[model samples]
Target: MATELEECFHYFGYGNHLSNIHLHNKNALKVGIGKLVGYELHFGDFPASSSAKNCWKGGLASIQEKPGSVVWGVIWKMNQTDLEKLDRQVMGYRAKDVTVEKVDGGLISCRVYQLSEYIPAAPSTKYKRLMVDGAVENSLPNDYISKLVAIEDNGQTGAVDATLVDSEETKKTVTNGDGVHTSKAIHQSEGYFLYFAYGSNINSKRFSVSCPTSQKVAVGCLKEFCLEFAIKEQTSGEKFVGATIESRLNASTWGVVWRVDLTELPKLDRQEHIKEKFYEPVDVSVDLENGESVICRTYRVLQPYSPFPPSVLYKSVIVIGAEEHALPAAYIETLRSLPEGPEHTVGPMKSYYLEATKN
Candidate 1:
């Protein structure tokens, strides 16, 4: 019987390329010592280890490291059967879970932590200084401060991409001391509004490359909603629920909200792929400081055309930094009461829109 790792490699056209098959006790931990045999390795996150470097070579191998380990890497050559086996094994691994997909004429696999196994760690405060990368330095527009805040607070790792950051010279020419005004001008003279985003975009720096003027709002509640969306073939057709920030009477969610200029709304709309006939904007009340309230527009799929049933969509709002505050129990229960879709019904999916509840 082929091992799981072997099966995964084969399914993705790497079966023959894999040879050395090595498996360590799932819980073993040593810097480099372990079973070595026909195993193929891929290195990420762990850079300096010799074992990680050996993975690039297609063959059998062993590595020795520390004892009483909590993570193990499975190395092997795989065919279709082997890939399937690996898939099953990966699903069983608690600390990390992975799925494979075909992309750009090749198979790619992504590994991430399972929700139950994920633990929030202390946030990093160190700012990355730009030294050698000219492209990166040139992209830091005057608004880079806000962009930096977004990136740091969101826990994103990586240098600011050129597409997102403008050069210092550009910043000097664009702003007359006001960052928001420069952003507004670029957004084309439209009224500014806030957009609350919790998921992938939380790494605000990355998100800012796409929306430079957005701000990291400090108030809101995290709401989990069953949203039927698809990413590049990587997600394996699994409909995942995403958390969004909302406002409630007793508590609020924390999240990054973009103070977007109206002119840029059209571009954002295009990016979100919102169409008038398929979606509509609805008003949502958000908690403000000092016992005040602000209404914001959030887009939801209209009746009949949505893909998933409401029961699966649990709405939990995020309060930007307040991960401790639980969303209203009533809101979660209410989501459970929503109806499910009709046996995988298909139609044009509804997209979201931006609406300003205030002037």
Candidate 2:
């Protein structure tokens, strides 16, 4: 009598998981070695839980495409049920398939896990040790092992690198796709987006009125940029300094990081008047106070105008947020000292948008 066979899944374990100990836990069948082309490795966004700090430090290991780059890892075969169980262990990561070249010179396709977005961050000493040990255990390459050792220095310096291959010597981070220092608009999955608010929107009460689903995540800092109130109301001439990212290496801007549900994105977009007229949505990758960086959607105006101080209500909203987030005390005082307004005009204008949502 003939017997039926169970369907199996194929994958390439590139990170610490390459250790046979982890594979045994997952009950995955270890195949042979495989080499992936046109991709490189980097430490991505922070790990799923802060409690796992000793494991990932700041970011988890991930792969991104880079011309003339390659990564070597163990190939494996696993049953469907086991694959599902393994997915739960790797939260905040998605598996994508790529064609790899086997050690025997055969090309085959396999799945690899990666973060939703690529962020430049350093990995923990423990995480790097696992990878280094796994690489030697699997005999990846002498140069590759050296590259893994250098990563320990990075975590100590708190500097991010473009790739883990060690040849590029990438000193600075490239936040946007165009490889230029300009405004960018980050797009996330349907459930949520990381929205960056540097103006009145930084205030939780005010921001919630426009986006009820918003949840404050962290206090963010953007490098090479400073706050400005260049845009003003055409009719009343009331000024409210929205966020404008100007190029000044020594300058920095503080803002709030909020997770806005995708369901409320449309309403918030319209409220911001993002019709390419005033305060258009932009994408930026900002570093948080906790030594992690993230991609967020922000706003900036297209036209440039002379600077003016923000109004009383406007400055008050910003100060309130700055204090609530416990941003540096000096920064909070700076916001309080900004020239405030004609309550006669600013009060009514603030009412138009600053009203709190009804409970």
Best lDDT among the predictions, by candidate number: 2
lDDT for each residue of candidate 1 in 1-359, tens digit (9 for 90 to 100): 97655444311111111211112111212121112122222212222322221111112111122343221222223344334334433331223323333222233343322212212222222111111011121222223223322432223222122232322333432221111111212323355766554333434433454567766554454232222322111123433222222111223333344466555555554333334322223334444343454544443332223233321212211121223223345533543354544322222121110111111
lDDT per residue for candidate 2 within 154-220, as digits (tens), equals 4331112323312211222223321112222324335787888887788788887788888888999
- Candidate 1 structure, TM-score to reference: 0.27
lDDT at 44, model 2? 64
- Model 1, CA-based lDDT: 0.30
Displacement of the residue 144 alpha carbon in candidate 1, Å: 49
What's the lDDT for residue 7 in model 1? 43
* Residue 349 in model 1: lDDT: 21
Q: List runs of model 2 lying over 4 Å from the truth.
A: 1-190, 233-243, 343-349, 352-359
Residue 15 CA error for candidate 2 (Å)? Answer: 35
